[model samples]
Target chain A: MTEFDREQHDHFLRLFMGLEESLRVFVRSLLFTHDEEREVMQEVAVVLWRKFDASMDGEAFCRWAFGVARMEALAFRRDRARDRHTFGDEVFELLSQTVLEHSDSLEAERHALDTCLQKLPEDQRQLVQTAYAPGVKIDHLAAQLGRTAMALYKTLHRIRLTLMDCTRRVLATEELT
Target chain B: MNTKDPRFEIIRRSRDGNASSEELARLEAGLREDTDFREAYVRYMNLDVALSAVAKAAPLPLPTAPPQRPRWITWRPLTAAAAGIVFGMLCTSVVFGFVAQRTAVKKMPLSVFDAGLEDAKQILNDGLPSQEGQWGIDHAKVVSADGKVTPLTGLHMLRLEPIPREKRVKNHTSRAYQVLDLRSLSASAMTDNAEAEVSASFCAANSGTSSRYLIRAIALDEAPAKATKNFWSKVESDGVVSESQRFDTAPGSAGWQTFSMTLRLPPGSKTLVLIFGAVPPEDGPQPASVHYLDEVQVSLLSSETPLP
Candidate 1:
């Protein structure tokens, strides 16, 4: 075989095997840990390898690979079904993927920070919830929620900083479509 | 804004601290220069108040305790003496039994994995013929609750009775489930050309983890076999919102895995095909025979009720 033949073989092998790494990255972008993402990627690669045809163009192949990855991710999500959570894994996966792809600017991150009310944990959620509620005073809320005025100040400060950081991460990772 | 002003530091430290009037004035001026800082500071102060309130409240609920046993009473001496005599004879038998019990019986309880396997076998036995090629031996195991294939056979002439919304589930290994609802969407054409559309506006209905389902259309075959590639491509190219996102898995995952997609059906399209097959890993076989599926669902995406 000529050198061209060897190069061609390498290209196909890369096409076939490199799909796994791309998928792993995709799963990671969905917030799945490296190992969990790899496990799912393994299943996807096996399926793709079996079904793939060399006749498929690169564009078609990428779409198909993405589709397979999405399906596998969904399947994984369904299998680990949780009853308590509101949004499903697919929505998060898609949203996260889209967000990461489209919105990578600092301005977007800052805006996300300004609107970072969604990611707060339980107590923080309640505090923000009350603060956002109509006509509620901070002093009255402090008294009702039973906080020392000083403690309330500190907690709010920490929450803002955390939200800012979280917003930056979220913006860096995702775009709203 | 320089740090050297002693009066500025005092203003910073004392919101209510025993600070002189002069120090307070200095702090106010510094805050006036940057409204954002003052806003952030006030926000922090408010949060401190709220967190303290929650901690003061009672703890979250705890799990219940087990039931208590009643106290035991002592027996009389004469009765106790008689009971001791009976116990002596019982003790001799118990000792003999203990010696006999030394032999290994080898009778062990079935494990959960074994139980799951047994359930899969039972499901295949009863569900295979009735499932009409919709069921394949994949990594997905048969869930006993929804594995009722026989009773559903020919009742609708379609072997797969979609596991009712409540009972249907996807195990980790299994990929997707396609329930073929052949009912036509268009009233004018009593034929199969009718289409179902899941547009972006209604994407919420299908955009989720477990609740999401894929759309694939396949013809009913005599042997419960898979549909042709032409069928898959036509349905896919026409109905799929993003062609790159269409996925299928091989038949052999040992159980049901879940595949979810947000489908936006093209306008004026007549049909939607959802394939619930598993995608094998890259290192695995080409055109792998992991599993096969013939069952699929056809419904109007925009309609309130899915076609039967």
Candidate 2:
């Protein structure tokens, strides 16, 4: 208890909790799936807290944590290379830097995606939810829906397309509001 | 979204994990070459991750055949992500289980307080006080707003009445209480500086009268059920430490206004009862105008930390 002040620990929790989701999203973008990010995120969180400075502001913490997540994920990816297909490190660097630059727009897009998801046809929304649910296998989902795996992937792709369009339109008009 | 755009297809396939080695190479080339394509890549990746989170947090009934956990157990992304900070890296599994178990109701914090009135009921006077994570109204009622009465936050708010159904007497004040079990707190978790920082938003549903609200929180050495038997009048008998905060709304208080108070938790505090009261001035009419309370919160805090 003496190593860290109780107030500083609480402050760390507040800042960490506030930014957890963004950090999760950042880590997830680097990894393959939800479960993979789960492992890396744990390490990233530990490192972040172990090195957290009482003086760092939220923005500084975010940038630093995202950097930690990027490093941890890339390192994890190196060991996980044999199991799955991964984009080149060059692509990862590009996307990571781009997301940081467009953080505001990405945040807007995050909220807009929520709105756009609600705008979908009910069945499509359900399909999207069921398809992306943690641990749901695409083949099983396709079979459950009585469609071929390829057809189901096409349907999901179309739904994402619709959602992306809606989100773009929302962001475009967000300035007017 | 333009189906004809090859870069868009590559981005979508990559997100869906349907891209081949050649397709991934093309995607990497596209990202390195086109600025807009790179933007699209980040957006798609963000969307992909968000969709997975949304799917996990989606309502309990998912249509797929995936192995599903029980409905009550919700996987809060942040909780899992923050578990490591509570314990060391090796203890994260333990901390995560503790937190994940603590949240029986999804989207609700792992605390004894329910700020949003979602789990509360309208049972009035002599009705059992709220259990942990609920509000037990003595004379008032927790009600859903249909249109005539509006809640400050969620669909429901705590409504304070001037008279009690059980007591039918001249009482303009209403009381609601919630209890917290502190046995789960590891002895070393919080220092003596641990405080319960409570906050709630209040609004006057009527016109032309100031309404006051107060919170009485006491830390006891016994269980809440035992403490509630005396309704905290015996706190003095037990020599327990208690704190109270009172605020009065101005005439025509207008929009929802929020207030906060902090109560320090003394050592050996096994149970905590958070008492909420809406008191009309003693000299005012016996049955004052109706007032609404919402967004009630009770958070454990370090001594100096303030509730927002």
lDDT of 1 by residue, A88-165 (tens): 444434433442343224224433542454457767755654543323445787898788766774565456456655
Model 1 stretches with alpha carbons more than 4 Å out:
A1-12, A17-20, A81-177, B1-308
lDDT of 2 by residue, A1-177 (tens): 223544565567667766665666666666655667766776676577668798999888878877887887877778766666665667767776777787778767766776787688888887877787656888998898789988997788777777778888999898778
TM-score of 2: 0.51
What's the i-RMS of each model? 28.2, 6.9
| Candidate 1: chain B TM-score against the reference chain B | 0.24
- Name every residue pair that clashes in candidate 2: B130-B136
Evaluated with DockQ, which candidate comes out highest? 2
Error of 2 at A72 (Å): 0.9
TM-score of each: 0.22, 0.51
Off by over 4 Å in 2: A1-5, A83-90, B1-4, B60-308
Highest-TM-score candidate? 2
Q: What is the C-alpha RMSD of each candidate to the true structure, in Å?
A: 27.9, 20.4
lDDT of 2 by residue, B1-308 (tens): 25356677776676667888888778778877888877776777667766765665443363244233312122111101101011112111111100111111111112434455654553443533534545677667777883456875457777777664345555546777777777665554444445555666667766467778876777766766675676646666534667777887777667676666656566566777777777766653544667777766554542211122
Which candidate leads in lDDT? 2
